[model samples]
Target chain A: MRTLKFLLQKEFKQIFRSKSIIFSIVFAPIIQLILMPLAANYEVKNIYVAFVDHDHSSYSQKLINRVYSSIYFKAAPYSASYDDAMHLIEQNKADIIVEIPQGFEDNLVRESHDKLYLAVNAINGTKAGVGSGYLGSIIRDFNQDIQLQWKQPGHFAEAQTIDVVTNNWYNPYMSYFLFMVPGLMVSLLTGIGAFSASLNIVREKEIGTIEQINVTPIRKYHFLLGKLIPYWCLGMIVFTIGMLVSRLIYGIVPVGSIPLLYGFLAVYLLTLLGAGLLISTYSDTQQQAVSVAFFFVLIFNFISGIFTPIDSMPEWAKVLAYISPISHFAQVMRMVVLKGSGWSDVLPHLGAVFALGVVLNTWAVLNYRKTT
Target chain B: MAAITLDNIVKTYGEKDQKVLAVDQASFAVEEGEMFGLIGPDGAGKTTIFRILTTLLLPDSGTASVAGYDTAADYTQIRNCVGYMPGRFSLYQDLTVEENLKFFATIFNTTIEENYHLIKDIYVQIEPFKDRRAGKLSGGMKQKLALCCALIHKPTVLFLDEPTTGVDVVSRVEFWDMLKRLKAQGITILVSTPYMDEAVLCDRIALIQSGKILSVDTPANTVKKYPTKLYAAKASDMHQLLKDIRSYPGVASCFTFGESLHFTFRQDDAQNIAGLKATLDSGNYLDLVINEIQPNIEDYFIQISEPVHA
Candidate 1:
């Protein structure tokens, strides 16, 4: 409609006239993408290992050497007593303490087994958990090495062992960037798109311009369309920038159909912008709209399975996770980009986002009133 | 048919436990091509009546119509045929003057060229600064630009709510002159103002107070209907003069207007005036002067709305 053209023109002019909005729109996603993955890494490293060796046996020294040689840990200054090692941990200078009992070599040779103790600083739960697991695996491997050297070849054949191999299917190298870039893109795009769109109409309300428009002959749908179209275009631009950054900076390129990824992004943006407009209708000021949008966006990010696997959440939380469009979009992004999934693979996610878009847009239109 | 009509319209705000009446049993009509004014001070329901007729609000009871369209049922039709300028400057401030005008014209399904003659007089005054953003404009310039945007559509009826509330005196006079020119084109104009002096400029005026229409007539007629004689009295100590006259038995209402107190009598006769003068002269009132004066729209507005007269 002719009216829509004017509305769109006016909306774009206002959007661009405010220089601060333009600056943030073009760069916020870039900055977030560049910094988030490096900061949100789950692979824990740089653990400080402190040792308390009472026996001072050759085997104990060998085990200590093996633990420090691994890339996951660094060696701390040696402690003469368990209490001294514990003091190191308490001072935050060491992450994990390894203590060997007295007569550890004699015990292992004659009794065929020995006891070792490990104390980990549990303040940062993830670091403590992962660091202790690495140390335990290293000690187990060292025990096998010593047993093979001491035992006879005939006895070694008598003991049978089960070998387990794992093949990382999607990410062969298990690069965290590859896993995080696509998911972070979903959250970043949703944030920029929803926040700007939510503030649009409410800004007009605060400035008193909405009352002038309400008195005109402009249809409600035309007005909303005018708003949604410009923001949708901006959302696409931000999405493209994110994609280029992921591919260039993180070395991540989608394996599936590029058009299919964009197709889902288009629908996902519609759903988010619809919710944004709904917030605008309920708020009387820009500050109120921003706060309400922030509350919803924060919850969506947490439940979207970007940082944690949805499968690991409790049953109630899992149910709530699936209800959010972000979870579906993040899943589709990972599936299509990482797994090379085709149309049938992502069809369900696309359908869910579309259904949500319809409900949100309908509610927004109904809530908007020309008169009270 | 009246160009605009409100029949016993009543509107209230807030919840059931605490209701504040904004408009109550108020009714008036404006004729075609006539300039009408709803004159009142702040919180006097002038803006509420404008909102009701503009289809921006619905009266809790009774019916109102604009350009022969019912406000409740035919709201969409009414919206299309009416141009409204709210009390606040509601145009897009971030937009340039030309862009704001063009936008309003486009949304109304008409081009600025189509109604160029209607807003030409007012728009020309603001044309030189069309490239400037509206927010940066002076108060008078902003008012002129708002008028142009509201008139771009050239609706059958125009509702302007307190258009000159914050404008300077010179610009206020200029705005009234522009409105007079629009009347020659046979456009029905309904404007409201808190400035009592602006009432006499309208062809017919309705004086409202406390959600009620105190009087609806021509400016001259409303003043002529003053029930009793009014006099202006001033002294060296104007404050004492007001207190002394208010306490007098013959005084119905007395309020300070400018340098003097406008005193109206409960019983107006030659004897009452003479007695009041003698009493004031006997007191410590210095250089006291009293003279009978003709009542204006403000005087009538105060007299009718006064609780003693009610």
Candidate 2:
């Protein structure tokens, strides 16, 4: 116990003394927390829609005005021919092209039908999908507006029309930032915990200081605990900074118990830091540790549904996602903060993280042999 | 009982077709409170022996013990009783000297104040700069700090591997003097150095080469064990002199030591020396001088490690 105290003291001193470590520990996460949400936005806006209007009718001009007036789209320069609009799409100046057929107003008024052509870039699949969806909704609204003028309100009521109202339950405003902030916090904490812990141990190996420690009577657990506790504290500090940044910048206050959140975090950080130590035990150099860590971090972020929903992934990927601790933490963070969930709600996540912590730290201790 | 002992310890690195033998059947023992040295050049398996006895490495075959505890089985006990300073500077360079010392002392479950007397003589020199980071210290100062940290625990056995390899001459002399003082305190010291002169300072040294112990004895006895009478000769053209002396049929081996050529005869006879002088004289060597001088540890090391047969 006394040995562990001294080792922790030495580790903390080294951590504070290194300027790069201090930057990475205290400020890097906060900066990433503030910057990443603003940049990694899933809500695609400012979609450029070019129009090819051959009808020369007032209804066609009104449809063009409605599409441009919506916040999600911007109006590209008017094209006289469909071939001219194709040039706009090819030049990357327009994301989607809407072409109205000849006699659009006459067809809609007399025949009560009209055809419209939509050409989407489809290069950026997400942007293209969302853009085309928005355009389809806007055209449907225009068709309804013309029909209401032609028929009385009570005439459609007799035909039995169903009215659908949508309520975004957890995120009422449908703010992507609210949905992203919780997951981003998990990613930041994971990054700070795993990379720092692994690199710190590998640094000692590179410098040969571990040889001196190995020669002493220091128990393996004492040595590993000494490494773990300091980084664990640093991870907590980074986590707090992320919380404060989310509150101050995004006005996101956790509805769940803050202490409960920290309770989950404490266990989660241990699991993450244990994984870092395990990597360090297997690696002899910091370069190897960082590369291995990069591989894991990349996989964790992508599959953990930090940027994409886990349900949308294939069955094999969803199974892998459940195995990752990040997914559970992100889920708990959203549930507790957004839905005001209590301890019983987050118990499963806490239990899984604790189990992973035990497995990882045990493997780390076994691999970290004093004699070889 | 021996303070440290290795019985036919064999350690190899790598696997299968590329197995490199680091220490091949190496066996030696250090009696309690004796200053012993493993004298050899780099890659001569000196560090490997130190690592094995320090419990940082395990031997593939045979057994080793430290302070009456087996290195492989009772490592925890061996680790507690032994102090090891590896060939590389192994302390935290970012840590202050005092912090590094205190850390090592605490890990050994002792306080610096408790072992103050053990490291006092060496620690006092570095105490003034205790607040400075170890990496900022000069090479000699770093070595002194490393020694102080190793001694802070007051272990019964101390293993120092090439502690003076990069130190200055004056500091190296001082280091040996400090070792003498440590010996007075009854601490068994097992040190290794590539410098032949340092071998003379040890009470007994095992001359090692290519994972083999060539000889183990007192430096003076090892010199006495030289197979033939050795002569040091120098002339105006020293390179040519070495060639001529080696070409002589009576000459066993010739090597350039500094500016002179030290050679031995196949037959240690006055007649053989006369024949060599005649041959050099016939070659019209100018400013030629030769003398039968007392052999040192280096001369014995060179003669015994030579591949040529007498």
Candidate 3:
């Protein structure tokens, strides 16, 4: 314990002494936390749309009003010809085009049927897909209204009585920042924790100071802990800063316990910092450690569903995602903070994280042999 | 009683075809409170031997002990008592000199204050620049700082591998002065240097070549071991003097020694300097001057060593 205290003191001093390391540890995450959530918005809006109307009827006008009124789209001026509307798509000014037939209202009135055409820009396929889906839903709602208005009072038919209502839980407005900021916090913490711990030993390796340390009476576990605990402390600080920023700037206060979030974080940082030390143990140089760390960090972030939902991934990928440490933390972060889940709800994930921490830190300590 | 003992320690690295026997059946012992040197050039396994003694590298066979503790089994005890300064400068370069010393001191569960008297002679020289980063210091200052850190723990046994390899002559002298003072403190110091002149400073040295000890004796004893009478000869044509004297059938061995050639005679040849001068004078050499002089450690090392495999 005495040895570890001195080692930790030296580590903290070195970490705080370097201008670049100080920047990376304390300030970099805060800046990323503040900016990344704002920039990484997933909700697509203001999709440009142009209309080609052959029908000047009130039905076509109502459809135009509905399309213009929805926040998902912006209405472009009516094109004089189909060629002009096609020009909007060619120039990238329009994301979608709607064409109504000349007798769209008459056809709906007399024949009770009409055909409409939609030309969607397939570029940026997510925007195209969601835009067309939203437009389809609006036209469907319009059709239902017309059918109800056309029904006479005497000819009413019996219908099913079940009323279906959907509620988006936790995030009623589907605010992307609330869901994204917590996960981003996990990513930045892992990057800083693992990279710093891995590079710390390897930096000593490069500078040749590890040889001096290796010859000392300090135990391997003491050395590993000494090298790791500083980064773990830094990881916690970054995590706290992220949580506060989430609450203050983004209004993303956790509904669950803050202490519980920190508790899982302690275990999670150990797992990450242990993995980093393991990399340092095998690597002879700092460059090797960093590259290997980069490789793992990339894979861990991807499988943890930083950009995609893990549930939507293929079966094998979802299985792989379950073993990823961050996924467990992300689960806890989203569940506890977003859903106000208690200890019983996060118990399984905490257990898995604790087990991973034990196994990984054990492997790291074992691999770090004092005698070569 | 010996403070360190290496008994037939052999260490090899790599696989079948690429194997290298880094330390080969090396055996030696340093008496308590003695100054011992492992004198050899790079790749002569000096660093390897130091690593083994410091409990940082295991020998492939045999056993070694430091301060009466078995390196393999009682390494904890050995590590606590020994201070190791590696072949490379191993202090944190980003840290200041004082910080580096304090850190090493703290690791041994001691403070710089506890051992100030031990390292004062060397630390005082570098203490003026205590805030300077270790990497930014001159080679000599860095050497002093490394020695200070190694000494800060007040170790019973000090292992310095190539401590003066890149140091300036003045710092090298200063460093040896510090080591002498440390030896006076009853610390058994084992220092290694490739330079032959540094060998004379040790109480005893193991002359190693190619991972094998060629000779182990006091500096004077090794020089006295030079079998035949040796002469330092010079000629106006110094270049031709070497080649011509070497080809003289009576010459046993010939090598350039500091602006002159030192050579001895074959077993059945004339031992007189006059006769040898006659032979060299006949060879197209100029202004031949021969002086019978004592051999130094470098001359002794050169004449005594043979290729290990041979």
Candidate 4:
């Protein structure tokens, strides 16, 4: 225990002395918290669209008015030909284009059938898919209006009784920032904890200070725990600052107990610190540690659903996400903040992260050599 | 009494085909309270031996003990009772000098004040920079601080591996002086250095090469055992003088030292100063001079390292 205390003190002194570490620890969370929420919105709005209308009749004009009425699309100048609309899409001036045939209005009125062509850029496949769905809904509403106008001359229509209700469970307004910011916070904290801890140890090795410590009577486990504890505490502090910023900037507060949120965060930080220890044990230089940490954090963040919903991912990818601690912690953070979940709701995530922390820490301790 | 003992200690890294014999089957012992030195060049396995004795590494096949405790079986006890300063300056550089000293002391379950006398001679030199970050310290000051940290616990035995490699001449003198003071306290010290001059400072020295002990004895005894007639000869054209001496029939060994060619000859050779002068004069050598010279530790080492004939 005394050995651990000394190691911890030494590590803390090193981290606090460096200006870069101070900046990364105290200011990174605030900056990320303020900027990420604004930039990382998932809601797609004001989609620019163009129309290639060959039909120049009043019926075609009604169809154009229906597209313009919905807030989803902002219609650009009408294209004289399909080539013009294609040019607009290629130049990124518009995201979607609609083409109406030469006899579309006459065909719809006389033959009672016409097909409309919708061309969507699928580079950002999610937004393109959503935009297409919104366009289809608007066209359906216009078709129903035409049907109602044609059938109600002087005939009495039968009235049917129907009840409809809707409820958005966790997020009533479906604000993407509220859901995404908490998860992004977890990712940032993990990156900071793991990278900094590993870099500290590896830096000592590179500079030859590790040789001085290796000769000391301090036990291996004590030395490792010493390095781990400081970063663990730092991780928690960053996590708290992230929460405060979420509340202040985005007006999002934890619906569950704050203590419960912190408790899970503590275990998750241990997992990250343990991961740092494991990297430090294997790497011989600070550069190697930094690069390896970059790879791990990158893959972990991508699969943790920080940028996309896990449910939207393929089944195999979802299975991979189950093994990621970030995925588990992010889910727990969202559940507690957004859903007001209790122990029963978060128990599974806590179990996985704790178990991962124990295993990784054991490996780190075992691999660490006192003599080399 | 033996404070530390190694019985045919061997350490081989890697497997069969690719194995490197870092420390071959070597054995030696240090008497209690004696300053033992291992002198060798780099890659001669000086560090491997220190690591094994410090219990940071285990020998593949041998029995060793430190202060009467088995190195493998009683490692924790051995660790607690020994002080080790590795080849590199491996300390928490981010910590201040005072904090680093305090930290090492705490690791041993002791306080710096409790063992002040042990490190007082070295620590006092750098105490003014107590609050300065260790990384920002000068090489000499850093060495002093490292020595202080190693000695804080006042262990029964101390291991220092190349403690003065990159240090300046002044600090090297001061460091050896501190070591002599520590030895007066009846603590067994084992230090390794590639600097042959330091061999004289140790009570006894072991000359090692290629992971093998070549010779181990007091410095005086090792030099006295050198069994060759050595001479230093030079000329205005010293390079040509060396070539001429090597071609002489009775010359045993010839190598150029600073401004002279140090040569050895068979004691029973008929060649005298006149014969050598005749050879150099015939070769058109200028300002020819020759003098009998006493051998130092380096000469003794060179003599022993030369391949023997059947």
TM-score of chain A of 4: 0.91
Residue A173 error for model 3, in Å? 0.7
The true-versus-predicted C-alpha distance at residue A225 of model 4, in Å, is 2.3
TM-score of 1: 0.98
The ten-residue window of minimal lDDT in model 3 chain A covers A154-163
lDDT of 3 by residue, B186-261 (tens): 9999999999999999999999987887888999999999877788888889888888777777777888777888
- C-alpha root-mean-square deviation, each candidate: 1.4, 1.5, 3.0, 2.6
Q: Is the docking of candidate 3 incorrect, acceptable, medium or high quality?
A: medium
Better of 1 and 3 by lDDT: 1
Write one digit per residue (lDDT tens) for candidate 3, span A66-175: 98899999987669677899899899889899988899999898876798999999988889989999999899878867766776676556222344678999989888
lDDT of model 2, residue B138:
91
Question: lDDT tens digits, residues B67-170, model 1?
Answer: 99999999899888888989899898899999999999988888999999999989889999999999999999999999899989888888889999899999
User: What fraction of the reference interface contacts is present in each model, in order?
Assistant: 0.94, 1.00, 0.94, 0.81
Model 2 Cα lDDT, one tens digit per residue, A1-372: 777888888888988899998898778887898899999998999999999999989999999999999999998988899899999999999999999999999998887779999999999999999999999999988998887776666688643267578999888999888899999999988887889888988988999998998898888888889989998898888888888999999999998899999999999999999999999999999999999998998898899988899999999989888888999999999998898999999998899889989999999999998887
Model 3 reaches what TM-score against the true structure? 0.92
Candidate 4: segments with Cα more than 4 A from true spot: A69-71, A107-113, A153-166, A312-315, B267-274, B308-310
- Provide per-model DockQ scores: 0.88, 0.91, 0.76, 0.61
Instruction: Tell the DockQ for candidate 3.
Output: 0.76
Question: A2, model 2: CA deviation in Å?
Answer: 1.5
Candidate achieving higher DockQ, 1 or 3:
1
TM of chain B vs. native, candidate 1? 0.97
